[model samples]
Target: MKNYFKFKVLPYLLYLLINFLYFTNKKVFHHPKLKDDEAFIFVAWHGDLVSQPLNYFNKRPNGTVKTMISQSKDGEIITKVYSLFGIGAIRGSSSKGATKALISTIKEIKSGSDVAISPDGPRGPRHSFAGGVISIAQKSGAKIVILSSKPTKYWQFNSWDRFVLPKPFGRVDFYMSEPLDVTNLEFEEARDFVRNKMLLNIVS
Candidate 1:
């Protein structure tokens, strides 16, 4: 029932609020660290995902981008939202059957897809680290880039991750750090490195 509300009911109603505020306030900043003809992974703090995507995709150089998401009702709404922007979302996340999710992510990347992830999402202690992304990058040999956004004006949801919803036409500044190549380390070491990199990028 709760999932039903989050995915089906609330999002549509929130659309008016999002559209009104986002369209009305529209300043954005972007940074990129991409390579030509190379596949990569993008990691962003869960709290910054909403506005970060709005800022990053405009400069995606690559025409098609794919994202990984949870399979809950909220995930359904998110998938719909991504579709509206012509982005492809793969349904899976860490908290629920993480191994399976990682496998799916690996397959997608091996197929030459540029993927995005929330390393501390699908359920969270509000930005705490998780191992899935590190494992994915280590196995697939994809360079991971961490990015974060701070909205000049927005609402912060009281959820586990304090999700940010930017007001229409608001100014959102995105800070993107250089990519961290994970092809050199073992599983555990790579995981810790990626987690630390994400934390540093987000907390700045």
Candidate 2:
């Protein structure tokens, strides 16, 4: 029983503490250029996920957002953390069963929920965007919004995506760029545009 608590419950408690510091201590600036009723796709760099949830759900505290995770042990841990924060996770990735994950994400958006995604997640080369996120934007008729966060102090994990943990009581800044529309573009063109736009938002 002690081992069970140590291995399972402890990690979740730590995750909750991290989120507490992130949401309570940060000064978030939201520039919502999009309409409230409009559904949208969200793309963020993996490092920016340290405070992603705080930015997406500010207006509607109970709003639903979906994200993708790989079907691995780490993914399982992340899924639990997201669930605790009221986030929905679809377990798949670009290298794995991406089609099913994309289908789930699209369905969520079509159902009037915003879909938050990390285009360069689940073992990314870091900051390189993929095509699937844009495809969802085109199919769902939703504008794509890029979200990012930069904390004044944090830990960067030495992983493929450089997972971040904002230090306790540190100030974090969230940048939500103006939404991108892909209403009347070809698949390839829309994908390229969204990818480039996200990359620009990350650095700018």
Best by lDDT: 2
Question: Per-residue lDDT tens digits of candidate 2, residues 1-204?
Answer: 976775589658967786678766656665566677777888888766757777777655667687888887767777877877788888898888899988998898888888888888877779777788877887788888888777777778877777777777767777787888887988888877877766653422
**Predictions in order: lDDT:** 0.74, 0.77
Strongest candidate by TM-score: 2
User: If candidate 2 were superposed on the true structure by all CA atoms, what would the RMSD be?
Assistant: 2.6
* lDDT (Cα) of model 1: 0.74
Segments of candidate 1 deviating more than 4 angstroms: 1-20, 168-170, 201-204
lDDT of candidate 1 over 1-204, digit per residue (tens): 986777777766655555566567756555665675676788887887776556556567455668888988778888877666667887888767567778877888888777889877878877777777877887898889787877677788887888877765567667776778878888778878877766763423
- Show the colliding residue pairs in model 2: none
